[model samples]
Target: MFTTGYAANSATLQILMQKEDIAILDMGVHASVHEGCAFTNKKTFPHNNLEALEHILKMSESMYRTKLVIIDGVYSQEGDTSRAKEIYDLVKKYNAYLMIDDAHGVGVLGKTGRGALEDDGLLDKVDFITGTSSKTFGNLGGYVIANKKIASFLKFQSRQHIFSVTAPPSSAGIVKAIDLVDEEPIWKDKLWENINYLKTGLNDLGLDTGITCSAIIPVKIGDQNKMWDIGRILIENGVYTNPIMYPAVARKDARIRMTVTARHEKEHLDKTLNVFDDINKKNAYCEKNNNNYA
Candidate 1:
């Protein structure tokens, strides 16, 4: 069993002794999995480094028979994706299993929006997949899809699944949304169009959106108060966005994160661009003039 959360990692570590453990391929900018079941038993590697992954797999073959590799499909911070196909090939070569936490990829990536594994041609090769419903699925709760054995194990042993209440009534409505994502091509298309448009716009405005290949745009502001001010200005101009400061982001690289959805049209994008332009220009002038407003 593998989990993307710290709790799951901890539980897995406890279940499998550290001495029996193998390596863990963790992203450099990924959320903390510091205190997990595999915390001490882990072999940490660079983010998206398939070469390093292969080396670790080769070294451990004599020591262990079952190898597990964990990664996220779409990273929450940078919004980029894992090289699932490359990793999947490694797993196949070594007779290992691969699990992906596709929290941000469903309905926002892939030809049919199945996620990075599908995008990278490794869907069938992956051993298991976990995705959250709160993001593009536009609902609550999370899901796990796997073979009968893993599914049965998780159903009975995953503490989160066993201890948590079942999916709510509204979750039934979400199946319709998922169906629409499958039946309607326009939603994903519009979502990508908006993503590219905003990404281009942010870059044109001299804002740095770190490695974002998806709809989640993090506009680096470099200061907490300034990031908050940027968010306030966007709101004042009728363009709502979030200010992500320290703890979530690096203290020196605070940002106003914006998500462009299928719901946003050209008018919305144009207005958002205008407001950003105004704020940046005003802020630059204030800094130059030593104005208190800056």
Candidate 2:
């Protein structure tokens, strides 16, 4: 295991894919994936654009010694899942490998929360699967699932893994958390209930929530300045949320990113929705063309 999820991805890719190999990625993958490909030839397709992905795969088919297509099981920003089945099929057709980073999907997707691969019935078929303990397990390590031979190679050859400190005592907590997810399915159910409720409420209020199918919801605010003002207003009113701006998203695509958890009660969500409603009504910030408030 690596110290951080970033290390797991970056270190592994750095070792397995070198100058001769090409790393084809979906644009929405985590920053870690991009950093991992620093030494490798890399190309990126627009997020979820199958046609673009196929074009790249087809073009690079005979050129690269190894081609790896990487995508996120659930995109962190847009909160949508990967088109895993279709992508996997295309990867096979091109004779390339597929890797999925399911950090945000693991404990929140599939029939038993085994993650996006399980949801798509490709759990045992994907070439590689990487995930973190920090998100759903509430711990602090990252792991990669691969064939026995590949797993052994990574454990020894990856520089970061070779020299990194052993996982802390809290590693046990991660195991327990995984068990809890299986033992108590009710939490997943509650999480979905909260997700649907909050998403519907925001949509009804004419807020742009983007195309989110996961707990990570983005309330889209086109203007960066207005987004900052709205973020401040929400915080001052006791509703904390992430104010995402350029670099995280495009300059004009600033948004407030919110994560819905099962622990949150209806009262908490209602309070949040009420605060957003009040802010929009007072400032008219939710309106598409209204930019009067300063």
Candidate 3:
């Protein structure tokens, strides 16, 4: 196990992918994935653009010694899932390897919550699967699933795994959390209920929620300044949310991000919707023509 999810990704890639190899990424992957590929030749395809990904794979087929395609199970910002099945098929066609980081998908997706690969029926077929204990596992550590040979290599050779301190004792809670996902399936059901309710409410109020099929929801608020203002208003009224801007998304695609949990009650969601409705009516921020909200 690695201390942080970042280390699991960055260190592993740094060791496995060399200058002679190429790391092809879906543009929406976490920042750690990009950092990991710093020493390797890297190419990125626009998020979930199968045609674009195929083109890159076809072009670089004979150029690199090792070609690995990396994508997220569930994109953190957009909250959408990667086209895992299609990508897996494409990678196989090009004789490339596939890695999926399911940090946001574990315990929140699939029949038994095995994550996106399970949902796509590619869990056993994927070359590598990396995930964090911090998200669904409710602890602090990261792990990689690989064959015995690769696992042994990473355990011994990865600098971060070799030099860094191990995860703390409290990390044992992650095991219990994993157990609960199976024991109490009700929580996952409740989480989905909350997701649908909030997403529908926001859409009904004429707010633009980007294509999200996961727990992370982004309420698109194009203007950065307006997004900050909206974020402030929501927090002031007791609805905490993140105001995402610039580097997180496109400059014109600033948004207010919220994570829906099973613990939330209908009253909490209603209050949130009411606050958003009030904000919309007062500022007309959700309207397309009102660009200048300064």
lDDT of 3 by residue, 1-294 (tens): 899888999988998999999999999999999999999999999999999999999999999999999999999999999999999999999999999999999989999988887867899999999989888776899988899999999999999998889878888898899899999999899999999999999888877787999999999888898899999999999999988998989999999999998899999999999998888888866456443222
lDDT of 3: 0.91
Q: After superposition, how far is residue 33 of candidate 2 from its true place, in Å?
A: 0.2
Candidate 2 collision pairs: none
**Candidate 1 segments exceeding 4 Å error:** 1-19, 28-40, 58-65, 285-294
What does the lDDT read for residue 289 in candidate 1? Answer: 34
lDDT over C-alpha atoms for residue 207 of model 3: 75
**Relative to the true structure, how large is the alpha-carbon lDDT of every model?**
0.71, 0.91, 0.91
Cα RMSD (Å) between model 1 and the true structure? Answer: 4.1
Query: lDDT (0-100) at residue 238 of candidate 3?
Result: 99
- Minimum summed lDDT over a 10-residue window in model 2 is located at 285-294
Query: Model 1 scores what on Cα lDDT?
Result: 0.71
Better of 1 and 3 by TM-score: 3
Instruction: Provide the clashing-pair count of each candidate structure.
Output: 4, 0, 0
Query: Among these predicted structures, which one has the highest lDDT?
Result: 3
